[model samples]
Target: MMILKLLAPIILFAIAILQGLFAEKINKIKWLKITLICLLLGSLTVGLIIISLDEKNANNFSKQQKDNIDSLRIENAQLKNNLDSLHRALTKGMDDRSLQEIELNKKVSELNIKLEPFVKLALTKYPAYDLQSALNKIAQDIENAKKLAEPPILIPNAQEISRDKTGLNMLLQFKLSKNQSLGQIIFYAEIEDGSTAKIVEFWPSTKGGAFNSGPDSKMIAPDGKSSRLIYSLIGAGNPTFDLKVTKAVTVRITSNYLPEPFITKIE
Candidate 1:
């Protein structure tokens, strides 16, 4: 669009053209017609110039907007590509972690199977103190192999607590048997000032037994009549019918093969 900016020059140009075309054409000099023609031509020229300038400005503005839109589209594409790459990397890491966890579980299962037989054999024989100790150690080893795992020995053993007066005789008795071969016996007993103690934690000490005796094909329980090897008579080891004891004491016994145990108390 184009427009005439010099308003006075456009008016003079329009008047000259009107004079050249109609000065001699009028009968008695028509002043109304002449002025009307000059005024109309002047207005048209100015309107055209303004319209041209407005069109040019509008075109320039549109081009600038298009350029900005193109630049934004390119930036958006780059960001989308970056996001996709990060997603793929994170997916790969998750897959690797899943695979590692599966392998570790399989290994643990295998180890547990291997340890089962040794534990079973130890309990079956003589059902003595050492055999039970070995069973406990095996369970401990299993626990150490795994991180943040519970102790296998959480399963309670035979435990009891009792009190006896200074002059009164106290007796310890148990029914014992073996499900496996004759392994050495292991026993635990403890004397405490108070009768109350956490039976599972406060393990008793052992007194008498062929503790570490190896491969005893023949085993005997002191009572013989009981058939199964019930070793303790008075204390955890042995004593007569009347024995003096002070304070309260607890005792616990375990055999590797047997699921059950022997427990008694005296004070």
Candidate 2:
């Protein structure tokens, strides 16, 4: 069909040329004229069929290209929608994280506000609250108090009382008026084994004279346990005791204006 279509126009032109060249001779034969006319008509019909088929094929190809382009556009639109969805999810997550951070900051601020009063109170009550030295001193005091609470063991015949000796001393200080004077005071000491005695011969200095106990006064010995004693002294210059014990002992001293026992250890 393609060969016929390609040669149709040439055949028509050749027929016309042949007719022209042998016009007088061909015209003289009716059959030859009729044959030439039929050949021309056949060539024209074949050319028209080829042209119609080519137009139909071009239309189909154009439709197929249009369909492919439309499909590509649809796929691109779907991809764009997916990207937009992903972007929206990421944005939402970021927003959520920001909100969480803001909430956390707000909670911290609220907590600080709530603790403001307590912080101020602590600062006022403990001026050196944040100081490491103050903290260490407090810890040491607590440890010492704990040690004082523990009971101690006494060594037999190992206790003695001495004067003008420097050992563990408990100095009692007092604030008094000049008009007021100290009266006769008594010293009492209790040992760890439930034994009690009147502490004598221990003189603590005063403003006017020294507070001295008689030699006949009983001597209270510490038994490496808790012991209590009471005395009366006035006018600033109070007496201190030189404690000597064979073993560790806790001494509780009570004097004038000193209701609470001042506890100490002699090691």
Winning candidate number (lDDT): 2
lDDT of each: 0.48, 0.57
Q: Candidate 1's residue-wise lDDT over 171-220, tens digit each?
A: 33223331222323333333334443322221113432222223332233
Question: Stretches of candidate 1 above 4 Å error?
Answer: 1-21, 25-45, 48-52, 79-165, 179-186, 193-244, 247-267
Write model 2 residue lDDT over 1-267, tens digit each, in one string: 679777998999999899889999888999999999899899999899899988998999999999999999999999999999999999999999999999999999999898676566555656866855554555576688876654331112123333343333333334432334445444433334332322222334343245545554334544333333334444434334333433334555554434454454434
> What number of clashing residue pairs does each candidate have, in the order they appear?
28, 1
User: Best TM-score goes to which candidate?
Assistant: 2
Question: Where in model 2 is the C-alpha error above 4 Å?
Answer: 1-6, 28-38, 114-267
Q: Which residue pairs clash within candidate 2?
A: 204-239
Instruction: List TM-scores for all candidates, in order.
Output: 0.37, 0.39
Q: Which ten residues in a row have the lowest lDDT in candidate 2?
A: 151-160
